[model samples]
Target chain A: MSASDYESASKGASSDVATFDDEEKGLFGRFHHALHATPALVPLIVLMVAIGIFAIVLGERFFSPGTLTLILQQVQIVGILALAQSLIILTAGIDLSVGAMAVFSSVIMGQFTFRYGLPPAVAVAAGLAIGTGIGAISGWLVSKVKLPPFIVTLGMWQIVLAANYLYSQNETIRSQDIRDEAALLQFMGIRFELGGAIITMGVVTMVVMVIVLAYMLRSTAWGRHVYAVGDDPEAAELAGVNRHRTIMSVYMLAGFICGIAGWIMIGRFGSVSPSASTGVVGNIQSITAVVIGGISLFGGRGSIWGAFFGALIVGVFELGLRMAGANAQWTYLLIGALIIGAVAVDQWIRKVTA
Target chain B: MSTEPILKARNLVKRYGKVVALNRCDFDLYPGEVLAVIGDNGAGKSTLIKALSGAIQPDAGEIWLEGKPIQLPSPIEARRHGIETVYQTLAMSPALSIADNMFMGREIRKPGWRGKLLKQLDRKEMERLARDKLNDLGLMTIQNINQAVETLSGGQRQGVAVARAAAFGSKVIILDEPTAALGVKESRKVLDLIQDVRSRGIPIILISHNMPHVFEVADRIHVHRLGSRLCVIDPKSHNMSDAVAYMTGAKEPDQHLETA
Candidate 1:
């Protein structure tokens, strides 16, 4: 059915429900009783349509396996990182330290593996610990100290940026001593051939992570807590939800994911450079992907899949600009315009719907 | 009805610095009855509700549930005792479906990740329960509980909130200004819902400024004046003017038998 038709039906059903007696209410009441029951099929459908349009425009080049694989590789780190930001945004909070945190943790990993001669697994763990520890501190400030997440994370962003610089001493780690794991980096970079389409391993991992996170947000009890805290903390508390614990958990989860993204970035670039990925593409792309995916910045209104689709939208837009021969500076300008446009449209839609 | 009061508050006091919001107030909620709290703005009506709901800790007070003294440290603690509150904003997410909002923070989950994917939210069960809850209060024309809350009219939204509290097994439902933003028809809908809740044996505390509503559903009208519950009068015995005069402290309570 059409969108308006479905809405009208819902409205009629709600009115009819007002006068019905308890025992008489039946099957219609069973399968579709949630207030947020409007399925997000529309956004998913729109994403697919956008992909089709891009494919048609890029023609043979976009349809090629090599190009598809390249896009996946290009977006892997930020795609996963954006998923992290989506969780924070879902709770009506922001983590400005995400990019810097990723860089800082990767620096730790570099130190562990290259400078201190630690195992890869140990280095990975060290990176995750650093990232998650910072996240815990930030979460504490937000929940316990009652600081705003935006300000807390913004300050952390600066701290982490400075720490990363100090930790690196303005030098790039170029040690080739760990040559035994060259294949490991290739493993992260490798692609599998399926039905004439090449999808990188990182792409598969990111897709799975996105689906899992989305499912967790939609189907789990913890997911409900996240939405509840975002919707109204006082009411959620009255309903027996642990608002502080959920908020902290969301921040910690975001940190853990960024940690993983850090390792993935190191693998992709073959080295860690302090200046190379500082604030990495401005974090604008990550935010853009999330908003474009249909997740509201206001929280309690979007999904993790929206973050995934948002990333693809960013990927497509970047590819489109390249195909159109736009200058390097225009890429940032385009993304900036898109972010503003998407947010404005979202506000407009909410007003109309409300 | 049990002999013991389901909920009680004594010597409840709250001060916002120097401003006394609630002063030495005492209140009780019995099983299977509707209690109407009437007062002008700044009469500490909201403050009393907040204290009862565990939104804030009272400076000096004791609460009891089922005859045992209790401490309402936070709202979560209040819900553990089966108290739910429907606020002025309805405490619902407009972007979500009605059933989702009703069952939020207490969602019915499947067994595992696989179950979550295959069985999902037991959506059918939640919807059935939601419908039954709504129907219990004579609110059953609603065909799709999956619809977003943004689509519903004001009365419908209020009704849905009442239904939500009922569905959650709230033994005492405190409604704060449920009809303030509504029109005449909508207000009547909410009043009927309160009565329906009372009929179901759940005590309801209806906080309203509308006297007609007070007389319509309230078994007892408790008037708050100058930071205290001046007096409680049976609706059947007191007229609107008598209640108002007492509420504003314009007329002293008449107790001919006592000398103070």
Candidate 2:
């Protein structure tokens, strides 16, 4: 048969079935379809709604340039960590040790510079290296040993947390000592005024990191491989993707980003303490941002930009709640609701798309 | 027609624990011909193709391409030898665009510093080529090259998979039941595509249970029965009932007939 003949036959066959194009769909169906097509839309809309409500309630306090910038500043650490978590999650994997790794690396930087008397720059590099090394171990376990990412990272989190305490002897690097000895450690905290808004170097770093990663994931072959692996590893492998290598690279990259977050953490707090209490919540917080960002926990969908907006939403909620004199627990309650709502939206979208 | 077979497999044996999937099976393909492999369910049709396509390594076998013995320990290795297999699953990522799925593992990088340093993919080039390949195969129903595979119909997805194989398969293409999940019209489109591919002079191995499709497009049909080849019959010489009888062990091949 000729191609046109087959085409006509196919057309006839398809006409037998009831077809519902996007335009023919009702309001809810269209909305669900749109959500599936553009993952960042829901999160972006939620962010706008949150901003509008908080701006109305808090009035001047929420709308003030300083308060808005303060939200950005407060979100810098978790935002950066969320970027790391986002990469791992994009590959259908999770890294529960991101916060511990950052804290551990920060402790290494402080202790190396003060006790070991290493140069500040060298100490920072060492901290970054240690973060990547630990990440490589996690990747090896995940890709080579075939261990679940969740289990491997969970174990790594505890191990790194313990190591941080033992290696630092539960000591806190005094902010004064860091300022006097390693002034560069405070570089990320440096800020400049721009149009009535205060912008810190840490915020710039976070923005740049997100932009670069978003571009890479959208345009690069390596980024495509990451998505491919997450979408379906067996299909990816048959199509010639190195599944193990892709999985491993994602873990290592997440680790490297977490290491950068560690440097930013030092700048944000100005002190590195080997305390489990403060850093223990890091994993959950980053995960919360990712979940709210509309990045599918199942992977192969969503964007880094969505995760960024997700982090910003949390920042807005926290500041808005404080300014409105609401109880702190209310923030958690609202965030919990958002997480559940976002996942429900995700499921709905999947059903419609599928 | 070339006298030498483009691909030849000898004494292939594969066993899964207690069950033997392929028992010393031998197979061959000539250049510029459509060879169809047909069998009952679980008759080791897929297993034999897997061995040839390098998805599985036979316990004892030798595969020859262009008259030279070659070892294909992996699917990637098979591709290197210009043997591409369009798996039953289609093996294309549904979330990615058609162009991305076409060049999933073998992406074309841009030339110069942007490609090397930044690892930038030549996406426009890939999309253009993907469009050309689809059009060349008369699979141009898809207007957008950037549409995700998930949005396409089952036949279109299969078209993309076949197009990928045809685009890259320089010597041999193996398709495992390309029309199994497709509708009648879609199956016709695929059969036409197989004829188009054969006219291009690249040999094809089509595995199917559809007797009419196999008879319509195949130059020769290999009847697989009980993990071994019962006979290789030319469509002009044997009828469908004869082939079916041989496949079901109700008839035996003439002793004078060639085995491989």
Candidate 3:
């Protein structure tokens, strides 16, 4: 029961005698412990190193304010989607339909305003509500029906994709029409010029979202419950956590975030195409960002900021390659390698701590 | 000790397919005493404890707490009735910090506006109380309350679980094999903690196979066999071999007035 008694007792129990003196560890052991203790550190270092490499290679172009702002603009959509994905991953679940849901929601917004004659503002709200509604369906299937998250979200992706095509009649809302009739539809695309960089409302929105979610996860009771459920649902339930409600809320919140992402997608493109090819890659891109950000695919680990950094890493690679006049295919190759590297590091951390 | 039992179960029956885990079992717990439920493997000791702790519902039974009939359909309901169970698994999240694990489900929020509007947790307060509880249980080896539970040794993990139960257990604490996984010194520490808990006037029901441990701390040993309570013996009057004999069905229990 006492400290001295516990030390002696534990020593007699196992032949591998290890003490709790963390300061006495070797350099490598200390580094391993630090990596396991703070998951964000690895990703943060990677981000910094990437920036340094790009800056050195591209010189004035990469370090310029305009290029930096462009990188922020490019990552906004995936960054938002990654935030949504992070919430699901934290609950030990996945959302394969994040991209489809965002695209479908965007199509709904455009069609509702232009075809259904609803006000642009009302159409936007309805689009967001529909995204949340679809998420509720996934959440119900996951929590109530007890289906695997991957399967449920996979099915939802196809269904939502098909619905987007059928409902819009394969129509593409032109930017000219949107500008002539409902200019507010492209409101988030509006940018203000700072000292040398132009910052869009979409990028600002992404920043605000990351900050709010980070605070929520770090400083709230609900945040702790989310981590608890991810760590062990049975233990969380025994400790008085409502596992069903927690999981359901996480799904619903992710859906709502995806809806916001959809709105940003519209602003980013200045057009709504039912067949937006990017919709197919949205889920993968978001997941990639989350994984590379040092957030555990298994859940109950990593920081929301890490996911943001992960998205930026992708953006940096894309822009850095383009500016350096490298083949576009190289971006994909590097990103693929980075994803593997991140997961390997995650495994190493888990092994050391475990 | 109070003449009337604080908690009692009557004719508890639980069936798992063809296997009858508990066949009309009955049990009782007096106030301010450590009652050890000991038996052979698969002798329904765990099943009986599960039914009592609200982890599993009995097919047909009635459980009385403080002389009142209570329905324990879930662990949350059990806690509401001032009953807490520390399972053999310990039931603490391995990746979560000790303070976070301690306040997993029942986290305290910041006072006034911050709690109401922002829904912020009172981390400082929770950490302070967690340290105090660990110290009260004489488990001060934990240098940081924010360290994850996985970093702790088996004995330390057990200490955290017991501390959590002791901090919140208002009426009765039920421990299922609390020391089954621990070593000699760790087991001794746990026995000391059990005695410490009893001194606080909280009755304990400890289900363990270690007869020496049972005899060391149990005021009365409840011998379980074949899905039912065989008998309850005063540890002072009966020895370990007698308890083991009754548990293994080698010896028949003497006819005595039912304690309940």
lDDT for model 3 comes to: 0.89
Instruction: Encode model 2's per-residue lDDT on A1-354: one tens digit a residue.
Output: 332354464564543433557666778777766777788898899999999999998888788888899999999989999999999998889989999999998998899999989999999899989988899999999889989989999999999999999999999998888999898877888889987799999999999999999989988998999899889888998898888888878888888888888888888898878783436888999999999999989888888988999999999999999888999999999999999998887877777454
What's the CA error at residue A212 for candidate 1, in Å? 0.5
Lowest summed lDDT over 10 consecutive residues: which window, candidate 3 chain B? B251-260
Candidate 2 lDDT by residue in tens digits, B1-260:
34989899899999999999999899999999999999888899999999998889999989999999999988989999999999999998888999999999899988999899888999999999999999998886887899889989999999999999999999999999999999877787798889899999999999998888888899999999999888899888888899999899898889755454
After the best TM-score superposition of candidate 3, give how far the Cα of residue B195 lies from its true spot, in angstroms.
0.7
Model 2 chain B scores worst on lDDT over the 10 consecutive residues at B251-260
Better of 1 and 2 by DockQ: 2
Number of the top candidate by TM-score?
3
TM-scores of all models? Answer: 0.87, 0.94, 0.95
Docking class of 2: medium
**If both were scored by DockQ, which would come out higher, candidate 2 or candidate 3?**
2
* DockQ for each model: 0.33, 0.54, 0.53
Model 1 misplaced stretches (Cα beyond 4 Å): A1-58, A181-187, A190-198, A278-282, A352-354, B111-120, B255-260
* lDDT for each residue of candidate 1 in B1-260, tens digit (9 for 90 to 100): 33677888888999999999999988877788888998878999999999998888999989898788988888767777888888887877766678877887667765677555643666677777887887787766566787777778787788898888876656788999898898765676677788777877889998988777788788877788777777777888778898898888788777731111
Interface RMSD of 1: 10.6
Indicate the residue-level lDDT of A75 in model 1. Answer: 82
Indicate the DockQ of the complex predicted as candidate 1: 0.33
